[model samples]
Target: MTAMNTFENKRFLARIRGGDFAHPGEEEAIDLVLSHVKPQPRETVLDAGCGLGATADAIGKKTGAVVVGVDLDAESVRHANATYRDFQFIPGDVTKLGELALPKMDVIYAFNSLYACPDLDACFASFNEVANPGARIGVFDYIAYDAGALAATGCLPPSVHSMTQMRQLPERQGWACTGIVNLDLAYAAWYARFLARMDENREMLAAVRSPEVFEAVRKRYADMLHCLEQGTLGGALHLYARA
Candidate 1:
């Protein structure tokens, strides 16, 4: 079980979220996405960079969709597979979904994962190869706000993207941009709630990996919250449909 990643037997996340998830908004984010585009029982949804299979499982339970979970991290995939049986979890790259032998996707969903990708344009194009015509894509992730502030801080990942680029790239890759939302306020609030939850369950969270690791995670997220509040980093929900 890794300390920072959403993998393995980390029951502490469930303690905070009441289920396994790797991003902000927890249940609220899921409900919002489902309200926009949910796959039917006959359809298959691809969970791009699905961290722990929890998001995919959540979608399955809500819509009866056949969900396939994919992640670049093999350990996360293995852990997700071991914990969840109703869905298939496999280790693969989001930028190359077509290379895998999985079924074509009707809807693609990612929870705070796509922003970390090195080549989002390539990822969008590759997803097109594995997606059925008219497939919808939804992503909740970090969006860049102040480039100068982001550069000044070493905490945020370099892949943090602007909302415009996020829209333009996907649209250029055969996706029709349905909408793009700025979730900066929501992201700040989420981090606050998450930090409060972690503090409330400090001892339990610390026990999962180690006290040292837990503190490191706490500090990292605290810094993230600071960035969000400072307008250096933000969050957003992007929606697109295959054209």
Candidate 2:
């Protein structure tokens, strides 16, 4: 599996987020994913690109499923192991999951993580290899609505896809997309709350992060807000089953 430290702002991000998640409304998103997947006890589940194992730990506790998280960052894996002892965190790459000696997963989910994958088709193909029959896949991620605006922000990964492409690509890779929930409004609301939280903790953040870092993070959020408001970018929750 490949390992790289792509999340350079992870520490400061954790501080601003007040947790391990990289996006807003993470808890609610987790609940939504879990409800859609409905993992069974004793089933093995995979949290691809799990950061700090927060969502993985929550999944394990809630479903009594044997949950394992994999990420490309060894430091994040080490931190996750130390912090969330109930679940296992390993250093690996999501695109190469077929090569990992892990148990077949009954449910696989990625929350705002798949965008980093350089090849979505290869990733899904590997996922199919590691999945048990009828296994479900849940992903919640940003969808590009206006290509020009999305490119202008330069925040999203180069591999980011449109909502139609996201659904189509997975289906072509042998997964049947059963549902697609548009979360654009919810995303906007989350950003609104996130900005408010940042404002509320401005002093604390300023003390921990440099002025430049603080401003950069704030600007990134502001840009995202603008994109959402302009219908340039959106969010979606997708559910799929092995075909």
In candidate 2, the residue pairs with backbone N, CA or C atoms under 3 Å apart (3 or more residues apart, or in different chains) clash, namely none
* Winner by TM-score: 2
Query: When superposed on Cα atoms, how far off is each prediction in RMSD?
Result: 2.3, 2.8
TM-scores of the models, in the order given: 0.91, 0.94
Candidate 1 lDDT tens digits, 1-243: 133454543345555666778778888988988887767886899999888778888889889999999998888788789888889998999998888999988899888888778688998988988998878988888988876687566565677778878888888899888887778999999999988988998898888767987787777778889999888899988889865
Clashes of 2: 0
- Model 1: CA > 4 A from native: 1-3, 6-16
Model 2: worst 10 consecutive residues (lDDT sum):
1-10
- Clash-forming residue pairs, model 1: none
lDDT of 2 by residue, 117-184 (tens): 76788879989878999799998888888877787887665666788778888888899899988899
How big is the positional error of residue 143 in model 2, measured in Å on the Cα after superposition?
A: 0.6
